[model samples]
Target chain A: MLLEMLQSLPQVLIDGLALGAVYAVVALGYTMVYGILQLINFAHGEIFMTGAFIGTTFFILLMGMGWVSSVPQIFVLILVLIVTACLTGLLGMGIERVAYRPLRNAPRLIPLITAIGISFILQDVIRFIAELSSGNYIVTGPSLFTDQMTISFSSLSSIFNDASFKTSFLIVLVTAFILMISLDYFINRTKWGTAMRAVALDRETASLMSINVNKTISITFFIGSALGGATGVLFAVQYGTIDPFIGFILGMKAFIAAVLGGIGNIRGAMLGGILLGLLEMFASANLTLLTGGIFGAEYKDVFAFSILILVLIFKPEGLLGKPTAEKV
Target chain B: MPILEVNNIETYYGGIQALKGISVYVNKGEIVTLIGSNGAGKSTTLKSISGLAKVKTGSILFKGKETMNKPVHETCLLGMAHVPEGRKIFSTLTVKENLLMGAFSVNNKQLIEERMEIVFGHFPILKKRLEQKGGTMSGGEQQMLAIGRALMMEPELLMLDEPSMGLAPIIVEQIFDIIKKLNQNGITILLVEQNAYQALNIAHRGYVIRNGEIVLSGKGSELIENIEIRDAYLA
Candidate 1:
């Protein structure tokens, strides 16, 4: 069993990296919101689900109009991703203004509960919309690529079969990485990003410095939710199907990834997300063999959540977060 | 016209009143000090003028225009800068970044660069630690950075709350010296300080506030020598 696991390590690593990339992108939404507001933004999962539905709906609409058949697949995918991101970004800002802004000075529990309530509201809204439009709970995304739409590793053809890798996975991984890098640069390099950091550090001071606190918070929601939207589009393409309820489990996992990486730390979210993905993949792949058939892929979520519980119990600050001393 | 005028301004925090019918003014290029003990509303007066605190019954006129209803950032953009009670500099931001944030309302890159040079001249230590984190510095350095940051805005009126709050006596003296220099440079100043003697010594005029009401107002030297002020505050 150990030798078999060793032989499959390379394949596991590739699969894990791709899956990890998706989680990292989604986890950023949670981390960025928490960093600024110290609120969990439980509704973020719904935003991701909304993005997927929106992307899927747009693709279906394009197909219905015969545009998908004529347009290049990449162009169609790019269009859907951009539209989905912008819509979700606006949705996120609306959530902030309507639900969270009024309760800014309320006790911490009030906003947190509001976030959870917003999450449910978003989920139900999407479900209602989906049912109204499709007459079904599940939404199937259009397949933009043919079976032949794959990149063959010609140089490694002799060692590993050319048919093994999917170009779609490569595209998702590269796109996620590029988005994450640009986000890092924006947060560190731009004036608006500096204003964001200032507001996160101290809102009143940031305002006193002539930085518009409301605008900064709004922009933060926009960027964070936009990333979630982009990730949602990628998830729909990779899975070929989405539902209003899909965000629940995936969002929980992304939340877990944020906590694992350090909830308020950006780089930590990325690290935690990739690590959680790799763990899920490896455990699911090797569980039966390692546990001598006692456990199987069906236990993947159980394994993943157990890590969250363990991490929370032992090192709640997470792998990269420092223990911050709260000023009285 | 006075650079700033506060007329019968009343402010509240929740149901409790913090500033009750307080009125004050600072003429152009004058150093006006508001001296009070803890919770006497010295900070509240500055906050009211800067639009950080809501005024229920008073009008704040800046450059002879009513500004009581303006938001904090709008007031800041209109050339009023408030260095808050605590050195509330963004701790994670580098020194240069904090100063740059001070100039957020100023869009001209050339003006920002010129102001940066002027700020460096005021607090030369800041130039040496431009890349250092704001929070890691000593109290005196942070105070300098705070003052330096406020100066970056090129405000017609600069309001400071407790600039010497936690600094050593020597650093406090240096900060007061810089405040005087800033006043001499043709900037109007509204200084609130618990260190009454030092505040009045540098002020052209001063108001003695106690329990949200002004008890005395006079030229700086006269108030410094007033028996009531000397007994109640200077001591």
Candidate 2:
């Protein structure tokens, strides 16, 4: 069974990379918020869900207007993604100002509880909006990419199934990589990025340097949530369906990825996200064979969390996080 | 006109009063040092002028403008720079990045470059360690980087809190030499220091603070020779 799994590893790896790309994008939101404010931002998942819905709504509206057929497919997709990300970024900034800003000096637990509360509020609000519009909880995204969009790998088709490589997956992976690279550059090179890092390291000192701490934090939220929103658009396109409930599981898995990669570290989040996605795909694909039919794809989620628990116990600072010395 | 004027400012941290109606002022092109023991409200006084500490009842006039109600960054934009206590340099950032952040309010690239050149001239070691992280550097280097960062704003008034803290005597002497040169080059300075002798040596005027109040004020030479200052602070 192990040998058979090794033979199919390439296919599993490809699947994992596509899924991992999405998680890395989403995990960025969690990691950034935690880095500056030390808040979990549990509402981030709902923000992702809202982005998916926003993208779906725009696509459906465009299709209804018959613009999708006339416009280039790539243009429409990019338009949808940009609009969704901007709207979600605004929503994230609004949430920070209204909910988290007031509680900045409150105890850690207070803001955490507020974050969880915000999460539920966002889910219910999205659900209400959906029910009001279509009288249904689940929304089906428009099929943006048809068979013509598929990029076939004819040479590799003999080794792995044709289904393993798809144009949508390639688009998602490439877009995610571009976003990550840009984010890395923005955080490391830009003045605002330096301000963000300074604020995260020492708020008082950052202020003394004349950095507008509040503005820096608001921009951080904007960028982080925008990344999550972009990921949501890609997820909706890849899956062709989204609901308010979808954020719960996906968000939790992304959170696990963030924690696994060392929650406050940016590069760690990317590495952790891809590793978690690969682990999930491999476990679902090979576990039943290895265990002689005792475990199957149904236990894949459980396997992911079990690994999270094991990692937390053994390396709580995470795979890439340095153990920080607590200041007196 | 005095560059910075603080009048009877009372600042509190929660319920505890840190500054009790303390007043100090700095004139243009002068080094004014505030010497005090630990917890003597020296830092609090500096914070109040920079808008970091709330003034319950007082007025801080900077260049003839009421600055008590301004935000920290606003005061900074008005040509006031504070190199805070503990040398609060951004440890995770590179030395160059830390200096760049000091120029946060300035948008002119040429002016920033000019300021960078001036900073490098003052502390040539910082120019060599531009890519090094602030935290990994030696204490004296970090202190220089902190001062270099404050200079990036090209401020008219520079407020330093304990710039000589935790440095070797030779390094502290080097830092004091830079402070004197900066004042000579026409930047007003408000210095807070535990090393009263070194501070007063370079300062044109001085204030001796104790337990949130100013106990003595005079010329630097006079304060240096005062029996009270010699026994309480110098000794």
Candidate 3:
């Protein structure tokens, strides 16, 4: 049984890392927005979903225009990522301006509820647009990098089965890492990033330092939503089929990853995302063996949520979260 | 002409008026202090000038620019830096980062470093602990950090709200000395304080505010000697 588990480990880890990469980038959006606003932006998931739909639509349009054949697929992916990021960034900013800004001083619950309302609106709007344009809500774009690849290490393949993955996995992983590293640098090293930290700490004081608080918040929304959207594009490329509902489940998972890592800390979100992904994959691969066949891979979400409950019970602040004092 | 001129400004919080027709002015190279007890709109007046507190009516002129209703950040661009009540230090940030935040309006790194040198001159302890977190420092050090942060802007008019609040007497003296030295170096100061005696001692001119109105204005020394002033504040 142990040998059997080991046989599957290589595949699980590879798949886990790719999924974790997706979760980590999406979780960043959740963590960053939560850190600054102290409001859980439920619309974020829909933003991710919207990105997937937009990316697939763009791919179809590009192919229709015969642009895909002329340019490198990687450049097309990059273009889609940029365009989708900007569109979703603007969407996130508009949500903040139209929905959250007026209710800034309102009770905290109002914004949370509004976020949910916005997500519902986005989901329905995407569904409506998809139905109108394509006569179906499910979208699958032209395969760019679906070539299968094998990994062989003479020393390692002897102990474990050789891992195999699609080229799209590499694309997703590379794009996510680049985005993550850039975001980390932007948050910690850049003036605007440090300024965001200041605004998170104290908005009034940040403004006194000549940092425009409203603009900073708007930028935060922009960056967060942009990352989510780009990750969504990467997600579509990795897994062929997508729908408006995909963001909801994937977003929930990423959010869980954020919580697991420590919601407000940037690096924590990354760690949490990758960790959650690997854990989910591990559970899915071995749940039957671990549970004497009582539970199977289908119960992966149950396993994932159980960990969240356990984490909440044992370490409420999460793996890297600083225990903030209770505030009224 | 005075570097800063506040003409009968009215400011409100919620539905209540905090400053009602309060006027104050600071000439170039003078230490001007606003002394008042708690809830006397001292902070609000400074807030009004710095664009932190909304002024419902009246005009604030900073270096000949009418800036009563400008954005808080634009006020900083107008060469006005306000160190708000309670030191308002970004305690989680390092002292260097805190000072860097002060230089937010200035883009040139060399100019920022030059301004930082001036700040270091004012507070050597700050330069020594450049990497230390602002909150981990003592109250006096945090206050110094706050002032040093504001000085990064190299403002023409520096407004401080309660710099002396919640500090040991000796630390308070050190802060007041810095204020005086800053004034001597041609930075006009607008000081708001609950510690009327200390404020008056270093002030070239003083305004005594009561219930959001400036009830008395005179030379600091003269106000310090007035009988009614002594009875209401000094005593």
Candidate 4:
């Protein structure tokens, strides 16, 4: 039994890691924008959803245009996804420039409410498109990725014949790792990164240093939105479906991951995401099994939210975040 | 020509006036001082020049341009640097990053590198603490870093606001000496202080402010010798 459990640990860890990578990517959208603006882009998850929709639409359009036969489909999918990310990222920038920029000096709540409004607006926009195209509240799109690739480490030939959960897990792991490393480099090793850190540390001081504060803020939104966009596409591939409303819960969870890791710290978000994913997995695995099937699988969300609330009350700064004291 | 000219500027914090129509000037290569008690708006004047606070009714010309309403970055670009009171160093950044931030307006890497060398030469302490975080430094060291940061900008006029606010007398003397040396090196200065005696000793001109208005303005030596001003402000 002990040997069986030990072997299952890696499998559990791998599954948790895959889930965590997605959360980290989504959490970055929140953490990056928050670091610079000190505002939570509540609409970030929707931006992620928009990315998925954009990728899905491109895949459908490519298949419709009969372009799939001329080129490798995955290559075309990658290009389309990038273009979609750029578009969504630009949209996020526009939202910052128009809605949040005017209220830059206003009380924080006003912008937060505006963010919620933008979230709803994007949700409606996606729903409207879904409805207009299909005349239905639900959106149905062609799948860009199929779960054909699998890796199995099984002694039994029957088990080996069954497709393992490697493809979805691998895509999540690889995409997340590449995106995070590149982002870390972009933030640390570039002039724009220095300006970003300066703005995050102190906006007034950055402006005092003759750095264009407005441009820095806009670029932050742009990058954050792009990350969200990429997450959207990846999420669709992982889940095998896309929905306009998927962002609502996922955005909230990513936000929870951000808070768990240390909201302003970049690496913390990644850490938080993976931990949250594992916590959910363990809770679902043991707790649902222990209650003799009455507790059910849906309570997993409740467990995750309960953890968030408890963490907030006990350590408001999150796990790795330092508690900042106001300077007199 | 004066590198900076502040003329009849009124600044207020929600109806209670902080600076009541204050006018001052620092000609090229001169050390001018604004000395006053707490709440007399000595810091306010420096803040106004640096675009930290709004000027309700006045004109501030930096290098022949009306810079009253320009934002902080715009003013910094026009060759004006401010070392604000309380040593507002970017605490999380390294000493090197702090110095580099001062040169944000200048994209020319060669000039920035030259200016950074000059800044490090003046404050060798900063060179040693280049990789250390700004907040971890001693109060005196932070003050030196603040001055070094301003110098990195290579401003025509450098404004120091209460560099002696919190420090040991020995550190204070060292800082004042550095101020004199910096002025000797041809950077115009507008020094603000409540320590009237030490400020006037190094200053070419001094303005004595009381209750947000200038009560006395004269040559630094003459102000130091005035019986009423000396007894009221200086020991």
Candidate 5:
């Protein structure tokens, strides 16, 4: 029994990594926007869902129009996914301009309430559209990435019999890693990135430094919303499902991930998400085995929140967060 | 003609009035100071000029243009900078990063590099701690960094509020010395201080405010010798 459990390590680790990538991607949107705005874009979950719906609509429309006859031309799917994400990102900007801009100087609660309202409106709009076309509330998403490439060490291939799972998991891992590194470079090395960081630190001082504070904020929202859109597309591809309300749960999980990593710390969100994912998987798997089916896999979310609460009590700044001290 | 002019500016915070028609001016290259008690609106005058706080009724002219209603960043772009009371440096950022942020609007990298060198020349301590986080610095060091950061903007008129607010006597003297050097180098300054004696000593001209109104204005030496100023503010 012990040897079998030891043998299961790689597969379990791989499963955690793939899940973690999704959480990290979604969490980046939460972290980046929060870093600059200092307001939780509560509407962010709806933005993610909007991206998934737009991608699904694009895929369905393309298929209906007979855009591509060959199965190998699936690369077009990625293009559609990107376009959908971009559209949803623009929608996010529009919401900011219309609903949030006027209240920029108002109390923090005002924006938070407005964001919650916007979140509901987005969900209703998507659900209404879904109901009009199809009786079902759920949106049907197609599988665009069907082709798989497997990695094998001949001796270990027998032990890891499921080659397809490993291939797909590797793809998810590589894509997330590349995106995270690119975002890190974009924030630290670029001129605009530093400007954003400056604004985040001290708005009044940053303005006196001649930085266009409003423009920097708008750009931050755009980038964050764009990343959320991309995450939605990747999520649909990974899970083979898309729904209008998908962002609700994912957004909460991502927000929890951001808090667990350190709310305002950029790199912390990524680390926190991965760690949370592993902890969640281990809790469900190990608990089932140890407790003899008394506790089920659905309790993973409970485990994730328990860890979050523990971290909050012990290290509120998160693992890699810098403790801030006010200048008197 | 003055590079910046403020005439009868009244400002308020809800029901309380901070400034009641107070006026001050900055010429092409002269250090001016506003000296008063704690709640006498010395900082409010600077805040109003920088657009951090709005003026209810006033006419402010910068380079012969009206700037009373401009946003903080817009005023900054037009060559005005304010070193706020607390030396609000980006603590999480490095000393170099803080300096770089000061040049955010200037796209000229060459000019920024030139300015950075000048700032480093002015505050060698900042140059030594270029990679250090700003929050770790002592109060005196942060004050130097704040002034150096403002200098990076190359403002035509630099306004400082309470630069000596929380510093030791020696550090205060050093800061005032830097202000004198900066003024001699042709950067027009508007210095506001609760330390009336030190401000008057370094300033070319001074205004004494009480209850948000300017009760006296003249050459710094003349204000220093005034009986009422000596009794109320200098003491």
Candidate 6:
């Protein structure tokens, strides 16, 4: 049993890394919205779901146009990714302006409730559109980057076996890494990025610096939601199947990743995401073996949440979160 | 004409009123101070003029343009800077990022650097701490950074809310000296302070506020000597 578990480790790592990349990108949306507004945008997962539908719609349309054969599949993916990102970004901004901004100064619970409401609205709207057009909300996008590749880990160690992944896995990893790195550069190096940070820190003071508080909030939503949307596209391409409900579970896991990393810290969210993915994958792959088949791999979520509870109890500031010291 | 003319401005925090028909003005090239006890509407008056607090009635004319009811960033673009209470610095950001925010309205990179140089001249310590996070600085250094930040825009009127608060007496004196020097450089100043004596000493004109009303207004020199000010504010 130990030898079998060891042999599966490499495969688990590859699959876990791909899933973690998705979680990392989505978790950034949670972290950024929470960072600026101190409000959890519950609609974020719905935005992710909407992106999947939008991406599939684009993919289907492109195939109908015969672009699937003429255009490189990679270029088609880029087009779908960009279009999905912009639409979802606009949806995010509209949600903020309509539902969140008015209740900004109201009781904190008010916005949280409104966020949940917006989430339902987005879910229903996408379901309606999908069912109306295709007779089912469950979508299976055209396969792209279906080619497979293998890594021979068994050559290095007798305990490890070869690990193989679809070419889409590399595509997912590269895209997510590019998104994360560019976001980091934008936040640290660009002028608007600095304004966003200032506004996040202190709104009234940021205005004194000529940073428009409302506009900055809008921009934050745009960027965060755009990343989520793009990640949704990546998810569809890798898994080959998507439904309107996929975002709910995946988004919940990503939120857990954010909490594990520190909700408002960007880098923390990224690290938390990838780590949670690896841990969850590892648990799912090896739980039955390790536990002598008493607990099945289905207990992976429970295992993930158990870790969250432990982190909350032991280090509430998270791995990279500031201690939030009260000033004298 | 005064560079900033705030006439009969009344502001509210929810249903509770904070400023009740409070009027104040600052002329070009002068340091005007508002000295009042805690919760006496000094900060509210500054907030009202700087567009942070909404005014229910009356108008605020800055640089001869009506800036009241406009957005806060619009007020900043109109050449008005407010270093709010407690030195509201972007604590998580570095000193350089903080200053970059101060020049947010300026599109010219050369002008931003020029403004940074001017701010550095006023608070040289900030130049050395450019990479340090704003929150990690000491109280005195934070105050200097706050003032230096306000100067980044080269505002026609600089409104400082308690620039001397939470600092040693010597640091307070140094800040007041900078206010005086800034005025001499042709920047109009509206200073609000709890330290009445120091504020009035540096101010060319001063207003005494009480219970959301301006109880007295006079030249800074006379206000410092007034029997009423001495009894109520001076220890």
DockQ of each candidate's interface versus the true one? 0.66, 0.67, 0.55, 0.59, 0.73, 0.80
What CA root-mean-square deviation does each model show from the true structure? 2.3, 2.0, 2.0, 2.9, 2.3, 1.3
Choose the strongest candidate by TM-score: 6
lDDT tens digits, residue span A134-250, model 6: 899888998889898999999999899899999999999999999999998898899999888888888889988888899999999999999999999999998888887888999
Off by over 4 Å in 4: A1-8, A152-163, A166-168, A290-294, A309-314, A326-328, B230-235
Top-DockQ structure, candidate number? 6
Candidate no. 2 TM-score = 0.96
- Per residue, candidate 1 scores C-alpha lDDT tens digits across A58-138 of 888887885457877888888888999999999999999999999988998999999999989989998998999879979
Give fnat (model 3): 0.63
Q: What is the TM-score of chain B in candidate 5?
A: 0.97
Which window of ten consecutive residues has the lowest lDDT sum in model 1 chain B? B226-235
The digit string of per-residue lDDT tens for model 2 on A211-320 reads 89999999999999999988999999988988898888899989889999999889889988988988898888888887789988888778877988899899999989
Model 2 CA deviation exceeding 4 Å by range: A146-163, A326-328, B230-235
DockQ, cand. 6: 0.80
True contacts kept of each: 0.76, 0.84, 0.63, 0.57, 0.82, 0.92
Residue A30 miss distance in model 3 (angstroms): 1.4
Please write out the lDDT profile of model 2 over residues B1-235, one tens digit for every residue. 8999999999999999998889888999999999989888999999899998889998999999999968888889999999998887888789989999999888898999999999999999998999988888888898899999999988899999999898999999999999999999999999999999889999999999988999999999999999899665643
Give the per-residue lDDT of model 5 (tens digit) for B145-179.
Answer: 99999998998898998999889999999999999
lDDT of 1 by residue, B1-235 (tens): 8999999989999999998899998999999999988888999898888888889998889998888968788888888889998888888899999998999877898999999999988999999999998888998999999999999989999999999998899999999999999999999999999998999999999999988999899999999889898655543
TM-score of every candidate: 0.95, 0.96, 0.96, 0.92, 0.94, 0.98
For model 5, what is the C-alpha lDDT against the true structure? 0.82
**For model 1, what is the alpha-carbon lDDT of residue A128?**
93
Clashing pairs in 2: none
Question: How many Å off is the CA of A278 in candidate 4?
Answer: 2.5
lDDT per residue for candidate 4 within A1-328, as digits (tens), equals: 3444343445556677888898998898899999898899999999998888887777677778775758865687578768987998999999998999999999999999999999999999998998798787455556544565644544433322222464656766888888888888888766787789889988876777888899999998998899889888878777767778999999999999999999978888888898888777655655556566777667877777788888889999998888886332
Residue pairs in clash, model 4:
none
What is the clash count of model 6? 0
Candidate 5: residue B143 lDDT (0-100): 94
Q: What docking class should model 6 receive?
A: high
